[model samples]
Target: MDSIRLKIDSRADQVALAGRCIHALSKVVVGERAAFEIELAACEVINNVIEHAYECREGNDILIEWIHRDGELQIDVHDWGRAVPADVLFSPLPDIDHGDVTNLPEGGFGIGLLNALSDRVEYRTDEDEGRNTLSLFRRFDAAGISR
Candidate 1:
């Protein structure tokens, strides 16, 4: 398997750059739609690291690894800041069935959307080492699957 690793400041502005890198890499194997899906999921993951893990701090580092092997793509987002809450990883989807768009919740969709876009999601955190990794996985071939 081949991998591309990127390390960037945990800033909101850098999320787009990371997303673009993910999109470009995924496009080669999964085409546009699936690539976009992967990119969006990745951006959400990065944003959560910034907003929650780093508490919106600017100087922390977030490392993203894009790995492709055996017809699968795995995106690993690593952070050395605050460890993610154990329960957040398995949180259920947001309750958007209010039948009123204006009454919808503004937040709480990050993990859900990440889960929906990728075939699998894994979260690992080691407080002793001050490391957290959020891995998003998807299976694809040359022709990719549609959403």
Candidate 2:
């Protein structure tokens, strides 16, 4: 198994760094396409933590951790900001297919995107601990095709 933990400030500029690091680490364990997918998912989670949880505030702590074993990858993102509403966190994916293209939202689609990109997604918050975690899981075959 391979694992790493990363900590960064809740700032927009730091997102790019996290993306790059995630991509590089994932590429080593999976194919380029799979790595890119993980990178995108991680970025979306981080952005949500910053914008929604931290309200775009800087200097707040965001922690990311990745673990790979048995051709499965698990990524966890933790933040010490506001807890996400259960309704929003567990909502079903938006039905964008039936909507008008122009009427579509430019953002607020991260949850759906994350669900589409990963094999599994989970979100948890502990009020007493003041921590929220978002976890993503993906599996790959020997050929590096995501399953």
CA lDDT scores, all candidates in order:
0.89, 0.88
Off by over 4 Å in 2: 90-93, 96-101
What are the TM-scores, per candidate, against the unseen true structure? 0.91, 0.90
Taking the tens digit of each residue's C-alpha lDDT, what string does model 2 give over 101-147? Answer: 87776766787778778998889998899999999999998876776
lDDT (tens digit, per residue) of candidate 1 on 1-147: 999999999889999999999999989888898999999999989999999889999999899999998779999999998888768876666888677989898988888888889898999887788899999999976456544
Deviation from native of the Cα of residue 76 in model 2, angstroms: 0.3
Give the local distance difference test score of model 2: 0.88
- Model 1 misplaced stretches (Cα beyond 4 Å): none
Worst 10 residues of 2 by lDDT: 90-99
